[model samples]
Target: MADWISRDDRLPVPVTAYGPLHLLARHVHRLSDTGQAHEAITAADAYLVIARIVRDEKSVRFLIQGKMYALLALGRVNEAYPLAIALLHSQRAAGSVLGEAKALCDLARIHLLGGHYVDCMRNLARAGVLLGTAPAETDRHRSALCSFATAATAAELYEAAAGAYEQLRHSTSSFDLVHAVTLLYWGLRLAHVGRSEEARSRLRRSAEITRAWLETDPDPTITAMHALALAKLGETTVAEKLARSVIMELRAGGSHQYARMAHLALGISLRAHGFPQEARREFIAARDLTEEGSRPDERPIIRFELALTALDLDSGQASRDLFETVEGQVRELWRLRLQRLAMLRQARQREETEAARARAEREILRDPLTGLGNRRRFDLLIGAVSPAREAPLTLLLIDLDHFKAVNDIHSHSVGDLALREVAAILRAHCRQGDEAVRYAGDEFVIFLGGDAEAGSEVGERIRMAVAEADILTDLHMTVSVGVATWSSGMTGEQLFQAADSRLYAAKWSGRNTTAA
Candidate 1:
């Protein structure tokens, strides 16, 4: 097992039965960082095998992350995409907020690779929300911040990318390798924003840090980054020579991934020194190499550089052709962006439509005057009650005594108030798994959970509560209730009819009474 991972990207690999698997996972990451993508994938697969045998879900996610990074580095974005999503879901299932945030960042990187800037920004925003409370000093937070910066840069949000890098630079308050890498991204952000002097300063610092590290371990990716820093600083002669040397070494070692970066570095240097023709050739070579193995988004960037170089070339036809090609690609990218926006708008519309429909349904089922379930709601509740599946059902049918006289002697408004008061009393008597409805003008129904005895008790309590209420005191309003319990063979309609007959008995036997 490697003692540590680059001293900058180290993670704790616990000494346990799965220690070998962890070691393998770290090796996979190291291989990917060194541009040995194929070897990294193979190592990741071996790690996955051991993790599966141990049934370690966390280990599995780590392996998936490593393999996915390797695949992405190899420009196998379609293959990496599913793995990115899987990592997100797995972390969510594990209920690790930090892990889920990291997974979101990984998914954002995949979106960046495909030039899906809108989607990339959305994922980065979500990750930021998740990491809002995470400690800044942790490796997970630093990793997520790095991803945010990279994605923001891809989306052309240079200010936001620079802000993230600034946070990363201040996280440890030390001049370490992590800070060095952050400086490089910070420099890239500055370059995009046209602050060339500031960009050169940051790049130089990052290059110096990496140069010191390279003396101990000759990492080609680090070497390429140093060349890029030199190129960006406008050290044209030395930058061009170093870039060429790095490209030759990487290509000879079959590390075309870093070779592409070296080519870009050389192009940048040549362009800065007024060698447009040489710059154009280097840019074209980089673009071709990117098409072979780099991320889909990288080729267009190289083409953009190529177009810029072509603007100063002697051949007008070549210049127009290059400009046209870049314009067409940009137009297609914009079209895709618009299509995604339209789909999102349509999805939001569908959700709003569904919500409006649900609100309308609720309004229809509710009584406007009493805020209680209406007749339609009563019917639906009764239809759901079955003797075969539940305990004996109880129905309480209630009516206001001399309710018409109250409406006639008093105002209709007073009668409405009295009805609302009765509904309140019925609701107070309702228990869990019970339904209360305003069945008609003055009649109410409640489906109770138990036998007729329980129904009669609730019905009596509602009767007394209504008789004593101060509402429309002069009208002396009181409610009579009828209680009916269903037998195993009785239907909902038969039970309702029985309750109605009992209601009639209560009216005849004295008002303000319960008849069971």
Candidate 2:
């Protein structure tokens, strides 16, 4: 263990100060994203030390979450569980329901690994209740939902798990590792329900996605799952070979938790190849690995498989006892399944209601024609700005040149198209924290963090872009832009008036130009 920890000398140095916490956190996330779990842990540990010293609760929570992810990635579920419990307590003390929900989901992940299906479902149910009022699109919400789906799979809520995975799959990019894992787990669920063909397709797609970027050094955990998928698909020879290699890698890397699954994969393939005796050994080995405080969530499945092999070996009474034990476990799982179903129904209703409310709110704050923020959103932004501004803020006011003429000549439809195009251009130019708004007909506003000089440069680019737009080629469309930097103690109205004056000047000087 010490050797493995010391091997990653190339890990990024932890941030020395609180200000660089964001950078350090990003570094940890990037390493995690690239499947560098050991490096991620080292980086996160460094960040965690600084975060604790600064007493920055947010940073501490984030660092803990990052470390938990890295530990789970390395199949160190035992190490992650206490962190998750601590996080849950912290979140509860902070009075943050959403954060608490996410923490519970993290706990569910631990329970899922340990073959604690009832506990997993119980945690997920509690998380669902906490998330009742949270925004559906938030990262915390999405991550919690993913945990729910995984737990649902283990708890035998096949339909619910499938639906949740499908929803998440549609929302995530194909290149995302989360998306690949979602597909992989969804495939495993499908296989559990005897949808072998669909399971194979999903597993294949997941493998392809991982292979796309992970060609150099693939994740052993995913490779092990892929091997299991292959075994389920009856590719016994290839599956056996791949599973053996994955088991060796996982064990050597000290990822004994995932190594158990690798053993299960090997067992499956060996059984498929008619070596029931050898397969039983692999199954028992997998079960034995659950000792020493390891999560035994997988033991149920392993025991079931061992019982099958026992029957094949003509150990009738031993197999029967194993089956009876498994049946008792199944009965408990079924009870949890019923509770989970009720929770899922209630959660789904809440989500749908909240989604509806959110949609209505967005529609109110958004411009229908341009798809930009409406005047209402502009008001909200301006109202939030303090008189003693902390940073330079520049506003750009723009008006389409001769937009009325375009409507008169080409009809109102063409005018609308031009507006949408301009809106898209504005959206493209604005930075992540900037705002672009459709103020009114033929008028738009951009709020950015910079001085007048920077604002003028952006205004000039927008003016040029609008003038050269191919969609407006025949119409000869152009725009006049005015840039105004907010002065200390200036009200939103004063800022607007200043930009308006500059915009009038740009129009007077000749349209399609910028004035600062």
Q: What CA RMSD would you report for each candidate?
A: 14.5, 11.1
Error of model 1, residue 193, in angstroms: 9.5
Stretches off by above 4 angstroms in model 2 are: 1-40, 43-67, 73-287, 292-296, 300-330, 388-391
lDDT of each: 0.76, 0.77
The lDDT, on a scale of 0 to 1, for candidate 2 is: 0.77
How good is model 2 by TM-score? 0.55
lDDT of 1: 0.76
Give a tens-digit lDDT track for model 2, residues 126-178: 67666656777666666767766666655556556656666666666532554
lDDT of 1 at 21: 62
Error of 1 at 158 (Å): 5.0
Candidate with best lDDT: 2
- Per-model TM-score, in order, reads 0.48, 0.55
lDDT of 1 by residue, 195-227 (tens): 688888888888888788778867776677677
